[model samples]
Target: MQEILVLYYSHRGSVRALAEMIAQGIDSVPGAAARLRTVPRISAVCEATEPDIPSTGAPYAETQDLEECIGLALGSPTRFGNMAAPMKYFLDNTAGPWLSGALAGKPACVFTSTASQHGGQESTLLSMMTPLLHHGMLLVGLPFSEPDLTRTRSGGSPYGATHWAGKDDNIQLTDEEKRLATALGKRLAETALKLHAR
Candidate 1:
């Protein structure tokens, strides 16, 4: 099976919800599977460290996961118009992959959740794409052709998928948001398959 790594850092579960939907879409494609992984929270204290295995949710992602996957779906909650620190921390350490060009030509998509409708979802998605671009990964985004993209009143974007989690972060994803997220995943998987076939 071809694996597409669904890598994310979710704090309030909003991003996690989106990640699950995306994984479902990836799995829907025959011969393509989702490898869900997450990174641990980073501590401000320089000496602090997280456990090797997380207490719940996905396992902490290793560099090997990047090497094994044919495609990538990166997600994170917005932090001041940018990706959360934990996800950024993980990507900051990907110099090894960058040097080896391990992710070159692999298809990638980004997703994000925000506390408000204007909580910088697009900026966060764009921020996350920077590292993937540096790795030479091809970006896949929601196109206007997706009906949900034109209809979504809550969370969806041409840049990628997004969720408006509300200030309390308790709002459920709208139907349109779910459909768009799933479509983005399927698109990434299909793109990866086509590229891999070459």
Candidate 2:
């Protein structure tokens, strides 16, 4: 099976929910598997560190994960119209992959969760794509062909899948958001398969 990396950092459960749904979609593809990974929270104190294994969630990602995966699904919580600091910090440390062109020509997609309806989901997705582009990865996005792209009043976009978790991060992903996120994953996996085949 070809593995697609579902790498993310979730401050709350919202982004993790979307990542899970996306993983389900990825696994639905015949020869695709989702390798779930997460990063530790960035500490405010320079001396602080997180355990190698997270207490309750996905294992911490290493650059080896990026090199081995056939494709990538990047997710993060929105932070002032940008990706959260932890996700950004992890991406910033990928110099080895960047130097070796490890992710070149790979398929990639992005997702994000935000605290409000206008919490900049699109911007966060775009910001996450910047480094992937530098790595020469091909980007995949939802198109109008997916009915959910038009029907999702909550968190679907042509840019990528998204979720509005409300001001307190209490909202669940709407059905439309779920379908769209799944569709985005399937699309990503299918695209990765075709590219890897070449």
Candidate 3:
């Protein structure tokens, strides 16, 4: 089966919740599966290090995860209109994969959760796409065809799936947000499967 990497960084757990929904979407594809991974928190001190494995949630992501997956779904909480430091830090280390074209031609999608409606959900999603683009992965966004994109008042975007977690970071994923995230995962996996079949 083809694996779609569901990679994310979630400090408040909102983005991780979104990642799980996306993974469900990926797993729904008949011949595809989800490889869930998360990055370690970045210590402000340069020399500090995280344990080799996290205490809970998905394991820390490795460079091999990028090369092995047929598709990718990247997620993060909005960090001042950008991806969180840990996710960015992990992507920054993929130079070897970039040099080898290990991720070239793979289908990819992005997702994020922001603290408020006007928070940088779309920008964070767009920023997450940069590294995937650099790696030559095909970008996939939630199209207008997904009815939720037209009806969602909370957090669905054509750029990708997103959620508004509120100020306390307590808002749960709405049904629409969940549906769109799953759709993105399915779309990415289906696209990757077709591309690999060729």
For residues 1-198, write the lDDT of model 1, one tens digit per residue: 999999999998988889999999999999999999999999999899888999988999999999999999999999999999999999999999999999999999999999889989999999999999999999999999999888877899999999998877864789999999999999999999999999
User: Per-residue error at 121 for model 3, in Å?
Assistant: 0.9
- Model 1 ranges off by over 4 Å: none
Q: Provide the global lDDT of candidate 3 against the true structure.
A: 0.91
Per-residue CA lDDT of model 2 for 1-198, tens digit only, reads: 999999999998888888988998899999999999999999899999888789987899999999999999999999999999999999999999999999999999999998888989999999999999999999999999999888877798898999989877864889999998899899999999999998
**Model 2: lowest-lDDT 10 consecutive positions:** 164-173
Rank list by lDDT = 1, 2, 3
Listed in order, each prediction's TM-score against the native is 0.97, 0.97, 0.97
Q: What tens-digit string does per-residue lDDT give for candidate 3 at 74-191?
A: 9999889999998898899999999999999989999999988998888898999988999999999989999999898889999899999888787489999999989998898889
RMSD of candidate 1 to true structure, Å: 0.9
Off by over 4 Å in 3: none
Q: Candidate 1's C-alpha lDDT?
A: 0.94
Tell me the deviation in Å of residue 137 in model 3.
Answer: 0.7
